[model samples]
Target chain A: MPQELFNKPVTELSGMLARGEVSAVELMRSVAERTRKVEPKVHAFNSLDEEDALAQAAASDARRAAAKASGAEVHALEGIPIGIKDVISVAGQPLTASSRMLATFVSPYDATVTTKLKAAGAICWGRLNLDEFAMGSSTENSAFGVTSNPYDLERVPGGSSGGSAASVAAGEAIASLGSDTGGSIRQPAALCNIVGLKPSYGRVSRYGLIAFASSLDQIGPFARSVDDAATVLGAISGHDRRDSTSLRMEVPDYRRGMDELRKSGRKWRLGIPKEYFGEGLDPEVGAAVQAAIAEYTKLGCEVREVSLPHTKYAVGAYYIIATAECSSNLARFDGVRYGHRSKDATDALDLYFKSRAEGFGPEVKRRIILGTYVLSSGYYDAYYLRAQKVRTLIRRDFLEAYKQVDAIVTPTSPTPAFRKGEKAANPLAMYLNDIYTIGVNLAGLPGISIPCGFTGGGLPIGLQIIGQPFKETELLAVARSYEERNDWRNRFPTL
Target chain B: MPKPEDFNLDHVANLARINLTAEEKTRFSSQLGDVLTYIAQLNEVNVDGVEPTAHAFPVVNVWADDVAEAGLPVEDALRNAPEKRDNMFVVPKVVE
Candidate 1:
């Protein structure tokens, strides 16, 4: 296996493919070899069909060869190997979402993101692990198993996009797609030491994405570099008639934004949200994030202290809203349609009970029950309605802060990756893991987490830079400035 | 915050359509109680006049033309059906 090829970013790999120095088949083979070697230790993939991946790679190579002969250019992501979160449908692949409910389910149509990746000539690798229906913070909720951090085998790769970040960090995949409802993408990227972006809600279509909380879910990219993240976002984002909520905005050339920002040498005013730095924040993680903020100052960026007054209500409001939406969305998975069916069921209602009871894992069931409680009679006004009102306040807080800052900075997670099962016993403790990151989702802003530095234990710390809605270009540029100045992104796990 | 005794686990589970065993029901009762206690902090906030935000962005009536487009073929749509009959999902008999 070629370590050099495995480590090369998509930009470099694309250049090699265009220059005819490397064939798409060769890149796929290298990745396949790497996946075979590291996957056992990391448990990053739920399932992989190597033969299919190789076949796609071969087609990409032939297409590139034909384009070169005709003096035409290939697609932007031609020959890049991309792994997709299992929740996102890729036609003909098992879309389990790391749950027994959909364990045998196969997608009939590609997700908008998957279709875009294939159109751009990227090889789609499916069945990456996630929290069952993207419910839990840690991948332990995955029915398949936990995806361990590549940096440390005992620690979790932050999830529900754990495998998405871990595979990219461990060199199993060049780039991967993960959906962020709360802090799924960014937290995992922070833990795995990679770049993860959650575009503004509706920036990307969710037609084929297994809906968790449709209002908050945004499929984004995880990569080794900010540039790669931007490239993948550009490819996947755009309006789709199939998804009525999808934004009807033009997708910007995010890759160009990086170079343009660099050439302009402009300064961005960044705000440090006061609430993020206090209470339950690990000292070492705080130090690393603060150091990254200081580096921004050195890079000619100004930092100001800003307060999101309603920050405390974010976690409660998020759970209320997310789970309520999830209860409705996941109801479609009853045994009759496409997911798991109960063999012992005697009637239609018995089938739903037995199937959902046996199919969904504990965390998912907990959420469904809680969501049901919140939306149930008599409780809806006190719980769900109040949470919605609080949600508005949280969103208003962000709107107020954006007036003073171009991007807001914080730690993507309260602490670095914790040992697997550490927070399993107490659901609230696990929910608190996303305290800093959840506020961004509730506000529906675009947020990116870039590897800032490492804790004393060698775990990665992620510095979150949040931007106003649809300002991912500025957000990425701010992240790029930090990523370029620091050598943190260059480090890879010993695995 | 409501005490653990305040919740009826069986009712909630029934509403969620999950049939939990005796042990799971007891465990979930406590766990759900703890989570609810934590979430009860939302009551501390003053949300008197704030409008609820259902969607992060405002969206309404995004209608496509009243014309049908090609949809998933019957075979493809039913490909993942766990049980089927006559090109339709086979569910347990509903009417007595």
Candidate 2:
């Protein structure tokens, strides 16, 4: 595969297709070859349907040719190859969510995002691995195996969108759609050296996404560059009748804001939330983020330190809220209705018991239990209720901080990806990796993570840009400017 | 922080309807204990008068209108089910 294709933004590729400079078949072939080559080392995908992907690409070319001949307005994403996280349902394809329970279960319908991608003429490659039910922060929780960060094979690719992030970074796919609940998308993007966006809760439809935390989960994009990320973002966003929580607000031309920001004489004012720069961040990542902020200073952007007083309690509030929702969403997986059923059981109750026993993994069971425990009648007020109250404060913190600053900058993750299995022993330590990101999700804000620099051992570091709700355009403006100045988007792993 | 022994995995597993073997059960207890111990850190933070939030943004009327939309066709929806006796999801007989 040529590095040119890897470096080209999706918009550029779309133009190439429109001008007959490249055919969809050729583009898909290049990426298909790359996916086969890198996936073994990176462990990025749970399923790879090469025949279907090629067919889809060939179909895209045929459609585009037909449209041009017929003088029809062409959809912008025609012929792009986008990887999808396994959890999202694509009609007639197996959607495992990287879990064994549904290893052989094929989806009966396409998820809202999947249908949108197909309609836009973007070919869907097989599903990518993730933490089971999107629970863990590291892809290590995947039942199959850990997804390695292509940047450094020894370290993790962050999860639960870890595979989605790594695949795009390694040039396996042009972009990917990933779910964000407590920073799953951004944290992984930060660790893998790519652009990952977490749309505000309800900004994008989640009808087809396998539920982890319904209230917090939103499907967003991970691409090699900010512009590519924005293209995919625009394609998948908009209200869907299938998802009740889907927003009906006008979908902005996300790319337009970047132009406005670039041409405007307005000064850049960025807030560095005090709590983000506090105690636990890795020194190297901190330095890299601060340097990135300083570069914005040269761009006529002013930086100021601000405080979000409720930051300390975000993790607690997140786990409580996320787990509580997880418990409810997962209730349907009772081994009877949909997927798994134990081979034999003494009774119906035993069937539900044994089938679920054999189906879900240990970590997933842990969450279900924890969620159930927290939401149980006895503990609801103390744990679940209090977490909800604090969740309000966490949201308020962002509103209050945004009142004083146009956008806020933080380390996408507290530290770079640790070695696989390093934090699994202590789930709390694993959860801590989300400290920098959980609040953004908690507050239903949009955030993006872009590679800023590297660690001492050559791992990637990311700087996060957070914007107020429905402000994805502004978020990308701050991100694209820094990305253009630095050109770190093309950085990739040797693997 | 909570003690390691505070959580009993067996009881939790029973509630979750998972039948873990003795060995698996033993392993889960310690792991669940660690997870709880970590979550216990949140107890120290004070969120007085704070309201618990369910959605990140306020999205009233997330529910679709009561429109009679077309649902999955019976044939297509039943294509994947290994065994179906009628136009519905099927399972082994629950009654003896």
lDDT of 2 by residue, A43-152 (tens): 89988898999999899999998999999988778988898998999998888877777767889899999988988889998788899888888898887888889988
Instruction: Give the docking tier of candidate 2.
Output: medium
User: What ranges in model 2 sit over 4 Å off?
Assistant: A1-7, B1-8, B45-48, B61-66, B80-83, B88-92
The TM-score obtained by model 1 is: 0.98
Q: Which regions of candidate 1 deviate over 4 angstroms? A: A1-3, B1-5
Worst-scoring 10-residue span by lDDT in model 2 chain A: A1-10
Q: What lDDT does the true structure give each of the candidates? A: 0.90, 0.83
* Candidate No. with top DockQ: 1
The residue pairs that clash in candidate 1, if any, are none
True lDDT of residue A232, candidate 1: 92
lDDT value, residue A445 of candidate 1: 92
**Model 1 lDDT tens row, A1-495:** 344788888888988888889998999999889899989999999999999999999999889888878988687689898999999999999999999999899999999899999999999975799889988888999999899999999999989999999999999899999999999999999999999999998899998999999889999999989989999999999999989999899999987977897789889999998989899999999999999889988887889999998887899899889989898888887898789999999999999999999999988999998888888887888888898899899999999999988999999999999999899888889999999889888888999999999988899999999999998899999898888887887788987
Candidates in order, TM-scores: namely: 0.98, 0.95
